[model samples]
Each structure stands twice: as structure tokens, then as C-alpha cells.
Target: MSRVATRPVTLPNGLQLQTGERCVADLGRMVDPTVYKNPEQFDGYRFVRMRGTPGLDAQAHLVSTSPEHIGFGHGKHACPGRFFAGNELKIALAHIIMKYDWQLTPGYKHRWEEYGFGWSSDGMAKLLMKRRDSPEMDIDNF
Candidate 1:
């Protein structure tokens, strides 16, 4: 999120925020290796594992948000539709995985490039997908 500083302020870490300057928060920085192990790599069950930890059960849920997990934002600014969005994504992914096989296009390599608060993958990146012969579960019942 971007905010314009109303007055100069010095952060606890000593970073200066100048008046009228636009400051953008990089959400990705919040989940850095300092906060997560092997953060640079993808792990589908990462949160599932975190949820199993004693104190993290509720905090690790898909729609749960805190200062550490801000996907749906935190506090009063949190998205009201986060719960609906999370369930929709799960249903969509379940159907997609049941009906099709998909993978990155052969020999395609892409990395996220960041410019200010914007990040993008290779513009030409593509995915290869094909219908599956049999779905593990009936998606129609969903």
C-alpha cells in the first residue's frame, strides 16, 4: 500500500520518512526468510504445517490476517470479502486440478521483476494444460 507522509518521522529502525514523500509497503518483505524458512522457495503445504504448530492454528488459516500475514490486510482495513475469495479460489483450484493437467511451458523460465511497488513475471511466459482422462473426484458435486 502507498501512503504520503504528512510529517517527517523516524522509524524505530531509524529509517526516515520525509513529509510528502510516498512510501510503499512491500508485502513480500514481511514473509522474508527472516520470518519463514526457505522463503525464497515455494511449498504448497507451508501454511498447513504452520497451522499445526500450537500457537499458529487460527493465524495460519486462509482468511486469517495479522501484521505478519497481511494477504487480506490486517486490523480495520482488512478485506471483508477475504473469506469468500479464499473459498472461491479453493473451489476453482479443486475443479481445475480434477479436470486438467497443467505445467509451465517447456524450457520456459521466469522470475518476478519489481519496479517500485509493481512486480511482474516474463510477459511471454506461458502454461501448458490438457484435459485429464479421469478426475480424482467429481467436480460437478461441488
Candidate 2:
């Protein structure tokens, strides 16, 4: 017999699920233009600007569990590692930015590919990177 995962419930988006059924939140819809300016365009500082937002707090770091940030999972099933993972990501990215110059490979066009309920980076996309001779600040020093 199959295990019943949950009781019937209605999601915020108005979708209903019966007992034992499963569903993944549609995060893409949350970031649509209705919720963000020029949502289709890339803005690296988007989260930076969003940090400390009254409701979002530090979750703008990009991984957290909430009704609107369910990508990190939800409720008791929510990812326990999200906080550590987010900090680890920040440290890694800081090192990359301070120790190297990077950019997309010139003339290489990239596009996101959507499959079913998710999207993936183009397999052919390329990035160019070169280590800096002198770093802006040593990350390990403090």
C-alpha cells in the first residue's frame, strides 16, 4: 500500500491536492513582473536591494523556507541546511569575485531551458575567468 503523504489541502495559488498527492510550489510565478520590476531581465543586485525588506528580512539571500520562499522546502519538511548552504554560497561567491575576473564567453549566447516544472541553464553556456594578481581583501584573514 502507498503511504498517505498529506490530507487534502488548497495551496495559496488555489490549486487543490487530495490525500497522498504531491506538489511542488511554482516559484517562477512568485518572481513575475507583478512582483518584481522587469522580472525578465537580469539584475545581480536585485537581492542586494531586497535585503532587509520588512517581510523578507535576510531571506533575500536566496534560500529560505516560507510560504513565498518554498523552494527551500516547507514546514517540517523544509531543508534544514538552507542557512548553512546560503552562507557557504556567499563565501564561495565572494572568493570568486574578489580573486578573479569573470564573464560570459564573448559571442556565446545563452538561454534558459524549461522542462516540465523546472528550468535549467543552457548546457553550452560558458564563462571565462582569470585569477587576480592581487585580491581586494583576503577572505580568510578575518
Candidate 3:
């Protein structure tokens, strides 16, 4: 969602310019072959490897989006509550996985909405989930 504009100037190739709005996309960097190996694949451990890499900052985790991965945006414009949001999401996911049996609806296929800038999932995917326990469940087990 970053907004940028170029300075009014002339180019060496004899192109004229006027100051106007421009789009600065970080999505390209997220899947750049030069920055990430097997960029097309959805590897959850991608950032884990990056964190373990020698000479890299250990504190810079997957949730800490940067120019390389702008899921939460970058720099000063990044999500201010990302850390809290990430932790809450992790806790909720852990609870669901530990206490439920879940699966996607049979023959279900994901559909994404395409746009000029990017794409997003249709958000109508179906899932079947049930509680693992018949009686009272113990939170301590989780």
C-alpha cells in the first residue's frame, strides 16, 4: 500500500517525465528466485532456514516482514501489532490442531480472486472438523 512518486526530470533516453503517483511492489521480492530458492514452492520452513543461516540476524523471523517478505508490510509502515497478532494466531492454531480432527471437504479445490496487483483466495473453502474428546477436555494436555 506504499505510495511513491518520481521527481520531474528528463531521462538520458530522451524520455520526458512528470511528477505523479507510482506503485512500489514488494510482492516480486517475496518470490524472487535470486532471494529465495524454489520460490514457486510454498515452503513453511523458508524463514527457518534464513534464521539459521550463518551471518544472518537471528531475531529477524518469518513474522518480521521486510523487503524480502512484505506480508505485514515493511519499515515504518509495517503493521504495528504484528507481534501480538502473530502470537495470538499461533495459540489459536495450536488449540485447534491439538483438540480437533479436521479435513477439507472432499473434491474441494481452492479458487483465488485475481486482480491487477495481486490475488487472494476465494475464502469459501469448506472444512469438516470435530472435537477429539467426547467428555470434558483438559487444557493441560494441550
Candidate 4:
């Protein structure tokens, strides 16, 4: 996970853009509703409606939000290790949640670092966790 940069660098137009970013694309921004019925909701099942349909190759597919899912980054610079990292993170977090009773302090603080155009966890608020005997909290919940 990344955090928004706190420092401000000058822009060509002298306008300040927030350093943090978010996904800005959706069906309305690309596909037409005459084709996509109700195009606004994030329906995980939306793809189910187009199962066996054909005739869509590269250019047509380019208009889709499917394969280019940016959660894995984009283009040649995209992470090459994402698949491994994803599984590892999932396994690790699952193990921790299943084996420990962890809670944030009522008033907690965090630190971060920024370099180049990126920011990362500062290692502060490392975590407060301990093993739990009860099996009530399932790792699957994580």
C-alpha cells in the first residue's frame, strides 16, 4: 500500500494537484449505456453477462476495463513480481489474523517516507499483536 505525498512540487500551469491518486475510470467514461444497460455500479458479476459473446478482439477489447485492470499496474514497467507478492501477502496476513489478537491503540500514529515520486510505510506503528488461544477469529475473515 502507498500513501499520498505531503510535499508539493510546482506544476507547469502553477496549479497544485493532490499527490495522492485514485482510479478514475468507469463504464460511463468509456462504454455507452445503450450497450451497457446500467453502467455505474461496480458489479463483479457484470462480466457474467457477456460470457459466450464473440467478435471482440484487440481494439474493441481496448475499450474494456477487463484485461488492463490497473491494480497490477500498467505497461512494460508493471510489476513482474506481483503474482508472487500477492499470494505471499495474502498468506502472511491470513496467518497473522488467524493466529493473533491484534488491535490498534486507541490513539495511534504512523510514519511514512517519500522519495522520487513514491511513498511507503515508515516502520512506525509497526504493530501490536499477540497470539490468541480462542479460535473465534478466523484467518479466512482477513
Candidate 5:
């Protein structure tokens, strides 16, 4: 969280204020309908579409965090390890998908808990996976 303050002043709204600590929250801006289409729905391809543009492509990558995405932060303050983290995630996901057949356990449901400033899921769902290298997978097929 970033802290900011305003010098003593009053104007348009006639609201008065003195210099004080302010916690700037960016999540609301991230999902604002004015800034994003279908803000309430998850669009995995949002950045992918933006990447089609020339200049924007450079900043649309997962690790290139900006004001539009504070997950890794923005500018020089952005997380330096984001590149390594993104690559590791991709490699892990690729290996998992290539090596196993998996599914969530029956009757499982997703749930999240709201903390003061964030939300977290317990991820209680169980996954049943089987190796894909068994007799069911014919080696000669490749």
C-alpha cells in the first residue's frame, strides 16, 4: 500500500482537509467499468487483445505491471522477480498438463474469505490425478 497526503486546502466540493496519511487502494481502479469492458467478468484474453497493438504489446505482457495492474506493481517499484515467477508458473503448468489426467473431487465447491484489504481462498478442493505414461498411453503414437 502507498501512503499519500494532501496539503491543507478546500475548493470545488467545499470539503476541508489537512495533511494526513492516506492509503491508496488500486483494486477499484483496476476493475472500473470505464477503464475495462465487462469489468465484472474474468477475461483471460484482455491483455492478449491489447497486445495486438504495436506500442501496447510491449507493456501488455504478464510481467510488465502498470497502473492498470498493480499485482506486481508499477514503474521502478514493480516486483523484480516477476519474470522468474511467470516463467516458473508456465513451466510447472506445462509439465502438469503433459504428465497427468486430473479432476476435482466430487461435491467440491470453491469459496473465498475476505480479509481487511484482500480475499483468499482455502483451496479445499481435492484433485485426483493419474500418470499419463501408463499402458493407456501408447508410446509409438508419437
Candidate 6:
């Protein structure tokens, strides 16, 4: 006789049915279908200025975060290292944007290789950047 094994499902509040790795919640189900219509389009600001559903926490400021966006992982078992990672990413991006003009070099091509389900761009790729001469780009009467 052959033995059959089955995996147990996890509940929302961190109740594990069967012992295993951290819960793998389906992050996609929590997204609002209306705002994320045709989610494959990849609109970066899709969740900006969104309001919480009526009767939910009236003060819930969910502007930047949505269940649809899994950049920071999800649920109770979410990445414990995310707080540090978030701050680091923001600081690095701010420094880069404030210090230099970032753009892809002309005629440069980006090649990628797939690892697991994700792909990563290969090589240094040679970004072209230049320092800004003006202190303020938008303000003229400074």
C-alpha cells in the first residue's frame, strides 16, 4: 500500500492547521479588484489616495499599502527584516536621486536571467549619470 500525504491550510489569525514553515497567505486575494483593474498593467500609483472601506477604521491610512502589493511580504509571518530594509531603500534612493541625474546609457541593453520564478538584470549595465548644476530644478526665482 502507498501512503498519501496532505498539507493543511492556515487561518488568517496565524493558526496553523499542520506544523510547517511560516504561513503562506495568498496576498493577491486582499486587493480591491476595482482599483487594481487589469492588474497586469503595473500602474505604480494604483493605490495612492485610496480610502478605507466604510465602517472600517475611519483613520486607517492605507494609501501606500494594499494586499495586492507584496513588496514587503505579507501577514503575521511577514519579513521581520522589512523595517530596516524599508529605511535603507528610502535612504539609498533619496541619496541617489538628490546627488545625480540617473538614466540608462544610450545603446545599452539590459539582459536578464530567471532564478526560480523571478528574473534579475545581468551585469553592471552602465548607467549614465551627470551632476546637476542648479540648486533648484523647478524654482526659477530662487
Count of clashes, each model = 0, 0, 0, 0, 0, 0
Candidate 6 structure, TM-score to reference = 0.49
**Could you report the Cα RMSD, in angstroms, for every candidate shown?**
3.6, 4.7, 5.0, 11.8, 6.4, 8.1
Global fold similarity of model 3 (TM-score): 0.68
Query: Per-residue lDDT for 104 in model 1?
Result: 93
For residues 96-128, could you state the per-residue lDDT of candidate 4 as single tens digits? 767888876657775567643444566555467
Task: For each candidate in the order shown, give its overall lDDT on alpha carbons.
Answer: 0.82, 0.75, 0.73, 0.54, 0.73, 0.54
TM-score of 5: 0.64
lDDT by residue for model 6 (24-142), tens: 44545444565356654556554442344553332223222335555555466456777677777776666667667878889887777764444557667888888777532333333
Model 4: weakest 10-residue lDDT segment is 58-67
Per-candidate TM equals 0.77, 0.69, 0.68, 0.38, 0.64, 0.49
Q: Give the clashing residue pairs of candidate 2, or none.
A: none
lDDT of 5 by residue, 1-142 (tens): 6555667756467866568845455677577787677866779998898899776786678788767778888778889999999999887776677778988887778676776566666556588998886544343356
- lDDT by residue for model 1 (1-142), tens: 7899999998879999999988765687455787778876678898899888998787878999877777788889889999899999998999999899999988877788875665657666798999988888887975
Q: Residue pairs in steric clash, candidate 4?
A: none
Predicted candidate 3 versus true structure: per-residue lDDT over 27-123, tens digit per residue: 8876789988898777888777778788555435746766777888777878988888899898787778777889989999877787656776666
Question: Of 1 and 3, which scores higher on lDDT?
Answer: 1
**Runs in model 6 lying further than 4 Å from the true structure:** 1-35, 38-42, 49-67, 109-112, 121-124, 134-142
Q: What is the lDDT of residue 72 in candidate 4?
A: 52
Better of 2 and 5 by TM-score: 2
